[model samples]
Target chain A: MTTHPHMALVLSRICARFADEERHDLSVLRDVTFSVRTGSFVSIIGPSGAGKSTLMRVILGMMLPTSGEVVRNFSRPAMVFQNYALFPWLSALDNVAFGLRMSSVPKQERERVAREKLKEVGLLHLENHYPAQLSGGQRQRVGLARALAIQPDFLIMDEPFSNLDTITAEELKADLLKIWRAYGITILMVNHLIPDAIELSDQIILMGAHPGHVEKVVAIDLPRPRDTRGALFFQDVDALTEEIRKIS
Target chain B: MIRSVTHPQAGPWHRIHLMRHRRALILMTIVIGIAVLFGISGYFSGVAWPTLLEAVLRTTYRLALAYGIALVLGVTIALLVGWSPFIDFFFPFFDILQNIPSFALFPLFIYFFGFTDQMIILFATSSIVWPILFAVLTAIKGAHKDLNDAATIFGATGFRRVSFYLAPLALPAVLTGSIVGIAIGWEAIIGAEIIANIAGFGAFIKNVDISGIDASAVAGALAILVIVFVINRLVWAPLLLESSRRYAE
Candidate 1:
């Protein structure tokens, strides 16, 4: 046990279960334990059915684990879902300002902060547009803007770039790192690509299927602004890929 | 660097705006045409203008009261019976209740309410509420799960959740249902009046039929058509357009 409160969030042997139509209990996650260090980028990497999304929900406190505990040291944790989840009825500005309104922030301040966040994500011009009017990339940016506008101590992203094209995803990944470094906020991202986890995270939590559990946690000691196409990056990517393949 | 600025003139909003203006113009023309027709029919049918006006006002009152009550109760019931296992049990009962023809229960209402306006209003409300309730129910049930998750994550709870998320999601459904409800309300109220011989448009039409069809009856028919057109144009049409513009699939 550490004396300092260094972890932003902690999951102690979390397990989630669901009952089917037949009332038979099905395990979705099992004995998943992890600690997210404050102000660091961590990625949860695994294949399909690895309970990655379920893990995110548990950490976000949206869903309760069956047998384990989740401790969030910070309040106001925000999430960007794989589908972006922008409200179709709301304008981009309104969507971004939603969390502030929920917090009962003054309207003017909410608009100002929402606009700033949108500008940060380079979506300032689309403030009046609805999600239906936006491209997939633009929609994800709006989701990012919305999450960031809350000024949360913790930001959880569930496959944020999964719906975008390759170029948009690459650009988004770069923008995300830039924001992470600029804000110095703790981020826990769930991603399917092992190379992406190695590229963006300070630590990668590899998860395995069969009632999904944490398999391994690998640290990336690479320097900031690391080149994705560089030799060191490739080696780390290859090693992590092989390890993930073995476990998953 | 100079660039060609091409702002598309055919965006959804633009198209809706144009459509609304055109619809309004057409509605106004129809209203004017109906007024002209009413005048012609009144002159030839020998129906006094004052009597016709009284009949119109009375029917309008009943329709407004019934439709208003249905609007409030339908949405209220829908919100109360929102997506849950309750729907599985509650909806089937609601379906059966709606199918038990309004006319079939007219005698029961007349016995209890004594052929008063209250009886007519209640009967009309029963007929009007089902469409709105079911439409809202379907919308609520079919709302995207991702949107629900996002709302929860953002700390939207209780009233705020309903206002911010559920209401807007269900708006199109509400408008569509309201249109159908109004139409059914018109039918039910008119039928109730004819059966009960209440002092309204239906009674006037029944009295005209007994006395013999004249130009006055034709004028009254024209007046009914005008009322339907005006309500659609002034109320339901705009609401439908607005809802579709914002929330349609």
Candidate 2:
């Protein structure tokens, strides 16, 4: 049971297994346990075989866990993918409105909400453009807008800024922080950059490979508007990097 | 990268509509040019313009009916086979069925529909359907995993997935497949007409070309070539350009 008050999500002894070509079970995740605090930003950092992506899918109920339990306090959850998997045939506006469209919302209402989300992401002027017509960073913003269009209380993101250049990524990070604060939603993200997690997260969950499991959960108490160049920020980044190296 | 290339005045969607209008104008000019050329040829060669025009219309109508039937039937079957859990079982079986010599089925169709327009139409449909079916099947098989996941996440499950995701995904394939199918349909319809002694362009030509390869045959060939070129310019090419722009990733 979660002793922490206001827990948004909880995973108890979660494990995932896939059958190999030879009909043998290959364990991918084992005994993974974690709880995400309500309205908090939590980041998962780990090595290649750490099954971070699998865990996220399991949490989203896209993939079934072989064993263990998931308790989600929030009803509406949305994900921002690493690849910005917008439907190529749809314009940015239609892509943002896709969820409401699927649920049979009236066209006018869905478009109104989609436009609002796009405006929030600063992509309202480019909403009619197709995914191929948008740059990488713009596409990611469109993706963020799409996830937000559903008015989700729980936000799940998988390396959402990995494909971006430094300047674009930094700008997006600032927007994300502002949106997080305004929405007061809980966010669970999978990322590799140590300094990024330290800057944006309240707690970081570190996982290890070879039957992936949680190694440690480090709490970040850094002040808001983090100074990346400061000694304390570098100290946390160095400590996190060292911990991951040990697991690797 | 965040602010890359935003069109302040007009987006690509606007440009595409403009391009379509230009394509329509160009197609009209080509049609006029072909008509004038054919008129001069008819004036000199003592060609039976009325009879040839009737034959062309009859052949075109038959081919159009055949293509319509084939398109709907082909795409539906392709979706079923491609998305089925038994794709591995059905796909190879379908491949073997498509390999059967096309003309070999004419006798079977004739047995059912006889030496009439129905026989010719059915024969052409059989030939046209294979390319559309196989093309769509290949497209569905090779679609990206990420797109599939995205569609599911956004609630495109059950029959909704067919219309919202798979159909559009198979659109470019449908265009290419129809082009190939129409070419094969021409051969099938002509051959069936000639063998069955039915009244179409094929019969019209065979009646006039008794001495083999005369001015009538050349005029017939030229007319057919012009029709093919016009269809390519007005229909397939424009759609191809639009599909590439709309669906490219």
Question: Which candidate number maximizes lDDT?
Answer: 2
TM-score of model number 2, chain B: 0.83
Model 2 lDDT tens row, B21-40: 68876876787677578677
How does model 2 fare in lDDT?
0.88
**What are the models' TM-scores?**
0.88, 0.87
Pairs in clash, predicted candidate 1: B45-B215
Candidate 2 lDDT score at position A196 = 91
- lDDT string for model 1 (A1-248, tens) is 33339989888889999997899998989999989999999999887888887787788777888988787888878999898888888899999999999989999999999999999999999999888778899999999999999998899999988889999999899999999999999999998877788889999998898689999989999897888889999999999988976884
TM-score, prediction 1: 0.88
**Residue A206 miss distance in model 2 (angstroms):** 2.3
DockQ of each candidate, alpha-carbon based: 0.59, 0.62
